[model samples]
Target: MAAAAAVAALQAWFWNERFWLPHNVTWADLSGEPGPPGSGIQYPRAGHVFSAFPLALGIFAVRLLFERFIAKPCAINLGIQDSGPHRAQPNAILEKVFTSITKSPGGKRLEGLSKQLDWDVRKIQRWFRHRRNQDKPTTLTKFCESMWRFTFYLSIFFYGIRFLWTAPWFWDTRQCWYNYPFQPLTSRLYYYYILELAFYWSLMFSQFTDIKRKAAKLANYAKYQRLCDAFFMLFGVVFIVTRLGIYPFWILNTTLFESWELIGPYPSWWLFNGLLITLQVLHIIWSYLIIRTAYKALMRGKVSKDDRSDVESSSEEEDVTSNSTKGVLSPSSNGSNRINGHVGSGQWTEEE
Candidate 1:
């Protein structure tokens, strides 16, 4: 819950680009020669219908639905299974299935059924154990599993003319048909920004003292954390430079109005330009925050109290010296000279 809240707060602060959608279609320069970027119309053309929808939806779906709701729940459950409760959460479900199997009269332990039933039960138990050990549910794993299960039927359904689906003319121009969406320059920039925000929240969640005990091995997270931060930093730079630097060229080289190749002409194109600027600016900010957070997280463990070894050693040395000085300064009870010379050398012949 804390992790979810942290992510929600970050989304509000850094990645709140929802306001840009309706505004993205607003006219920036109403008087300019009109035509959409490639077509000469005020609205999206049939060929470019897919481009009308932004890529932000895919990011949202992945983050909110798949990751937060599905994967996160499973991960948290598995993480809690190490020692919590007598039965790991999944075990309870597994036991129920086993009981159902055992209760079925058709699955009776007759001559040959005994061996087969034992093997089947063992397989089921093994699967449950494996699932219990995976503390985090990966999106890729779930996607791959779904893909594997569906691929055979999908292949059968589109056996002969599957190549038609691959054609750009028939497929959506936005590159978001069956595969994961939001791969374009505009969409991907924001996607990275979202990931940056997510990583920031993840690092914050890891900071909880109680959770820290569970995640002491930072090496597991350090690799991906650094990679994500580095990618966001680079993407942010590119976004800012591309949007600001190329806006003039995209504006000046407008032949779509003359060619009648665009629907929304300059007005629609300007909207895209404005949106690009806004998104890139936000991306820059998001990346900056992510970098800051990641750097802090990376240094957190290093700055911990474990570095007291040097101080402890020095204190111990000082204590020994102080004790020696006190012993030397103390007067002998019988007025006898104490250590008149160096103890090791033993060279003194008379007491001072």
Candidate 2:
């Protein structure tokens, strides 16, 4: 059948060894099965990577349970409450515009809607504000999200430390390239990578509804726990030493310079190193932003918000998040009817 033929062609293209492995390598060489009797070497199959996709779904289900019981109780104890938004009144006209045209319309668009519905422009605009607010994640919801991340990071940190304690590469950097891609992947390392892959998949699944900010202090900040000056200072030093120091000098040097001596350049090898270098560049940019935020918090004697955030208000800020400011209703002549206001200091704005 045409479908079967297409599927076979697609598989052939995707599984092409030339695109993934270095020259002289083939899929048979990567077989994970036991070899002839008396042979001690083990080569991991590349095909097994597909198994993690289902595992990732299982991890996501576990995360939902973990958030409900563990993270929810913790958030409640910390004074974070899940507050539901005020529902918008049913207006088919406004709702249609919201779904199809735009959630937050500019001044000109608001004027058109005002006349179309034969209602006050302010009323229509306020409806959109409340509607937008309905979609914003509650404080406790955001807290639970941060808690999940913090939990995974903390657990994985210790796990990695313990797992690598006796690794050959842990003792000598040169051991990293001893056999290169032809090396056997230990059972422990394979599971570690699969678990890591699943965790990232969980994040990806949740990202559609989650708050978009990438702040490091969200977990602590949401819990209302103020970190000590010593902790920030120590964290700053450790972050720089690890990210900017050991990363490039030790890890990058080994992968880029030393690895060349073991396995010469290949398409797949270049692609892998390209992603690695991209990550390093991101680390550099993040280093500057993170350090600056930490420095500001130190000077101000508090961690206020994400470094990228500005003053976030409900009516006004939601418009910012929606990528338009004109949704803010024009206040009364005296400006006393402004519906937008700031939340408490502990609360965060919608900015990412």
**TM-score, every prediction:** 0.23, 0.77
Specify the poorest-scoring 10-residue window by lDDT in model 2: 343-352
Question: What is candidate 2's TM-score against the reference?
Answer: 0.77
Per-residue error for 199 in candidate 1, Å, reads: 23
lDDT of 2 by residue, 1-352 (tens): 9999999999889888888877788888776544554465467676567878899899889889989999999878867778756678998878888888556687888888878888786677678888877877776777777677778778877888887999979878878877666776667777778888878877788777866443244545454345434445566678778989999999989888887888777777798899989989988887787689777777778655545443334545554544333224345556454534344433332321
Best by lDDT: 2
Q: Note the Cα lDDT for every prediction shown.
A: 0.38, 0.72
Clash count, one per candidate: 14, 0
Query: Residue 216 in candidate 1 has what lDDT?
Result: 17
